[model samples]
Target: MTERTDRTVLLRGGNVYSPADPFATAMLVEGAHIAWVGSDGAAEAYAATADEVVDLNGALVTPAFVDAHAHATSAGLALTGLDLTGCPSLADALDRIAGAARTADGVLIGHGWDETGWPEGRPPTLAELDTAAGGAAAYLSRTDVHSALATTALRTLADGLAAQPGFDPDGPLSQDAHHAVRRAALAHLTAAQRRAAQQATLARAAELGIGALHECAGPAISSEEDLTELLALAAEGTGPEVFGYWGELGAVDTALRLGAVGAGGDLFADGALGSHTACLHAPYEDAGHTGAAYLTAAQIADHVAACTEAGLQAGFHAIGDAAVDAVVEGVRAAADRVGLPAVRALRHRVEHAEALDEESIAAFAELGLTASVQPAFDAAWGGPDGMYVQRLGAKRAAALNPYAALLRAGVPLAFGSDAPVTPLDPWGTVRAAAFHRTPEHRISVRAAFTAHTRGGWRALGRDADGVLVPGAVASYAVWAVEELVVQAPDSRVAGWSTDPRSGTPGLPDLTPGNPLPACLRTVVRGRTVHLA
Candidate 1:
């Protein structure tokens, strides 16, 4: 599985998106580092000496993307197992489950079922699920992964599961009850099955021009053994780089032992809005009570201070406004206790920071926290008639995922799909952020693209990677694009033209209806991992 990177390669006759030479049409890769980026005429000097020369044939070359937040095993399972992502109705979903159960050897695990849009306006009842699976053990996670429907057979696997909070004998499981059942269901997978699932996810990532992935694993979300195996597989040099984040309170030693870059990610401050579990200051419009709060500000402070002292990044999954407030409060307290500079230097993260306000945005910039956000959430659930409005009403819903405001307030952004909840489609992610339904919340395509690429590297304290420049890692993708142009949120700023004199590197035209670029090849550390 070892990939060779000893040869020098010259790539010429294409648009190169490199800040080092904005108008460059060629690049040189010497071993695992970028050596040069300049005009086509300048590339001739290296062409004679390079071990390999590739004719770009009017394509585009840019830094490969980094998915800042992901769950490998879950994504893989969704890819290989029964997926209910777009099931038209509860009956259709149940039919799919019934079909899966006839051939499923063990637990009939399935994911990505959303009941909001169903004509029934509800998830399958416990009896309905049992009937669908023919009374066999089954677990079907909701699209948001915050809640799930578990058959009686599956619930039996976890002793006293009914006693756990968020458990409902006749409805979907959430919180502790959901976590317990998910673990039991995952345990049914054989080691070989798990490995295959992880590999499948990685292969898909590479194919989509992804150079790296940040795996959000925890005791509640995934097992230590699962994270270890995934890291080992990635180390074999056959796929995108995997950076692990172990989400648990005071788990520094465990994180380091498991080769994790941080002790946080899915370290839940709260749940998600789709399940009506995201901690809100006010009660949900549909539900009578405020959503759940998994951690207090004090608890958050303790975790952040400990992680900062241990030299590990600390992050939390805070999707509700109240949850975001708690994170901001706790991180600020940690800065007070550990010295602001030390805490800020770690560049800690907050996963799925979908809810924010002016204060939280300012706090994030002050604390140097990376908002590991997923634009697909807004794309999927934010609008006049979407789930956010259903849960929080129009005014509050309009405030969710304010990327433009965040950027204005200086909060760093690292984009991801939070896959299994959203699919891993990098260009689609950028497009979603650029064309947000709330027009005021939209950002430039270039900014969104950078957040998916270099911003991810910056989040991990790898300042120089995720870009194409001299001395940077040669991790980039070759794309077959119809055209390249500079895009800005404001036409005046971009000059509304494709002029080389602008000195701004162009990306594929990402207009709403335009086709996305097709990946022709993907290279990581100067080694080709994918080719079309």
Candidate 2:
């Protein structure tokens, strides 16, 4: 006999896309999970005996958004960094850095710098960074967060990259150099400091209608602090559920021991587009440099072999076409050498398969590779003369973030925001994917939404999260977009809309005399975690 908890709630009038359902319908949430979903009249039996009945009144409803690739703590840290995200000139960036230096006493760390937007290419150098820091050591990460720009003082302490493959004597550290400094800087954060930042980030995420996050906290070497704080936070029951993805393959054993399941973290083979580090088949358009690769095809294959040997699933970062190809190559090598069963539906992933070619996408289907991509990256940076366009030029840039094509080609799709790079707003991500700048690569809202929800589960190699259905996990969100919740500040609401969900006819115009209201209530796991 099933135990009746007598805790039923009927959400009527809202249009729900069950993610797996054929169409929209109403759902009855009983306690922590959906007990039934059908016609409005079908939920009446439960409504008669329900504790609460919410009238959604024809609002668009779907499963809570899932961010498959975010840097949680890094995003939390963004709450207090010298934000240069929308600066006009290099001087503006310097001014912001100098201002931050005035208050912070410890090593000054910052993010969000793009040379493409600057008048002069990439500012002066270490001398300028040193000047901006005053006496405090400072490190500025690129907008892509794949590379770091370190001051001379910051670089003096580096010993690991003395003879590394990509190291340069006087040039700014593009890949490994910035990576080393990032690790050291992160290690400097106290546990308390990290936790506080994480909490703040969660609060903000909840406000943005994000209920769960797959935090791609970099490789294990770099993400140890982030993971520690994240696990601690989850254990303490302070915030939303955090699925940690540690990128280094060596960390697989530790993660498994830490109770990380299939679809775990591993290195695929590359970096991102903002920096020319994404391993690409061809050289960068303007810079004339072939992107960089982290793991060689053999190295990734060995890593996969390790995961298979240990009965674990693995995923990694791959941004450029070359990087996507490298992952396919590595997966092929693993399946060929390690034989079969150890892999198969483990749903191993490739983070940010942004520049995948038609051929490489076919490989994803052939090898059953899961692609965890950030939709907001394209939305915010996908305009004409954007990073991809600058790096790959018009035709190739048009091919970037080919979501529809990848799906048509049989590649499993998942969406993430890579928070810190992009704020962890699932709806924002959904909206971006729905309206990709290039029409050919545009995917249906349903397709993008599925990727945000169930696709997240697939990325984790599970059938649980990112869905709203009977027999599914009791995890979901209630958004003001469906509930008519209203708030002034979006950063305050959790599990709800950040602004009022005004029912407008179409997309809000961005011209003068018009500003869209960011209002929504965000709830998760049957709890009102955020209100707008």
Candidate 3:
């Protein structure tokens, strides 16, 4: 028999895109790992001694994108279930419902709509949609996936949903409750359906060049059963790398037992700016309500205290300024009671940080909190006559989405697309940061990439990735790039993927100077998982 050798493969002539240096040339991969990455001279040694060689013809190379925040299983499920993501207006939403109503034997269910996009800011009543759908039980979630607007027939079925603490039939559902119905409806899917969902979701992530995902599991949204399903899949060596976060209030330690370390998962310390439950310092301009608060200040303190005491890194979902303050005070109290060592280990976080003034941004830096934000929010909704415009008024909306402010104030920023709420495209996210609505707040592409990678990895307190140094795990994306679309320093440059196929529909004009290129391949832990 001929000699069988496990040997090296050299990838040469690629424009390197590393955090510290971008001009590095050539890399050597051996035995499912990166062996050498340096100048072209290093390649000869590999060429003389290695097993295989491939010339890149000067394409760009970088660490694979990591979606720091997303719901993996659910995202997969949504693609196969009912995608109302492209439905434009209320009329269009109802028309789609009418169509899906005829095909579905069970509940006519879908997600992804925004009342703000319609001239009428409220969803049509159940009766109105019921008439159109012939009472097939329709449920279409708002664009953010925070709330669902349902028809009478669907409401009846949702009411009868015998889940635990959620899925109430009395009124429309938001957040936790919204998740319950979604889960129940998904339960109707067969094994074939689930597998298809997982495949599509993973394929999309691969196309986006995502090597890893921060799986933010929530109490009502993702369950122990869900974790089991994912872990089983991973054991079989399938799917993108998943960094799971179990959103259990009291069972985080158990989560650690299941091989998940903390990164994020917080509550509606109040709700969202769209739902007008941001727990404002003052009331909403039009609604005249001070938003909403989930826990008492003391209760909030207890949560922080509990997490710190448990030695877990904490992250809270705070959007409105008041919610931000609540978390800040609670974090301070937890730090004081628990001591310095406890405080430093916490790395407490706020999910949205959407609507904040100067003082709040500084407080985040001062408190050592991470702004676990989704920059895509600004790119999509920060435009004129958008959600922020009507909710906060033009004057207030003008300065909204303060990514630049947070960075300038020394606050550590981490990027995530509360997935299912938004598409988990890391390239899109970097573009959003590079081409922010307010140019003054625009961050460089490197900084934005860091937020998505290293900053996220650091927040999780792991030395895992976001870098391509020796001993670092081999995780990266190979680009068949036409251009880098995250930056635009001048008018002569074009940034972002204007191609509708590159990202979710309705993507804003948010690019810096470099145009987006296609992700040819994505690999995790030395294994190729995604290929264009």
Model 2: residues >4 Å from true position, as ranges?
1-7, 19-26, 39-44, 160-171, 218-221, 262-268, 480-519
| Model 1 stretches with alpha carbons more than 4 Å out | 489-496
* TM-score for all models, in order of appearance: 0.98, 0.86, 0.87
lDDT for model 1 comes to 0.92
Better of 1 and 2 by TM-score: 1
Best by TM-score: 1
Model 3 misplaced stretches (Cα beyond 4 Å): 1-7, 19-21, 48-52, 157-171, 175-180, 186-192, 483-515
Q: Can you write out model 1's per-residue Cα lDDT over 1-532, one digit (the tens) per residue? A: 3456798999999999999989899999998899999989989998888898999999999999999999999999999999999999989998999999999988988899999999989988888889989989998899999999899999999888989999998999999999999999999889999999999999999999999999999999999999999999998887899999999988889999999999999899999999999999999999998899999999999999999998999999999989999999999999999999999999999998887888889889999999999999998999999999999999999998989888988888999989989999999999898888888888888899999999999999999998899999999999999878887556224334588887888887777798988988888888888888
lDDT of each: 0.92, 0.69, 0.68
Please rank every candidate by lDDT, starting with the best.
Answer: 1, 2, 3
lDDT of 2 by residue, 1-532 (tens): 1223446767777655564442335777766677777767777777778877878666545566677777777787777666777777888888888899899856677878777788876654666777887857777777778766676666666667656555655545666666777776777778777887788888887776666777665453346556766866764433467787666655667766555554344354777777778887788887778878777778778877788777777887888777777777888899998775556657678888888777888788888788888888888678686777888888888888888888888788888877688776666676677667776776655567678878887777677666767866545554333233222122112222224233311122222233322425444666555655
Clashing pairs in 1: none
Name the lDDT of candidate 2. 0.69
Best by lDDT: 1
Model 1 TM-score relative to the real fold: 0.98
TM-score of 2: 0.86
lDDT per residue (tens digit) for residues 75-189 in model 3: 8756766777856677887777777778886766576777766756567665667776787766666667666766665554444453533343443566555656666565565
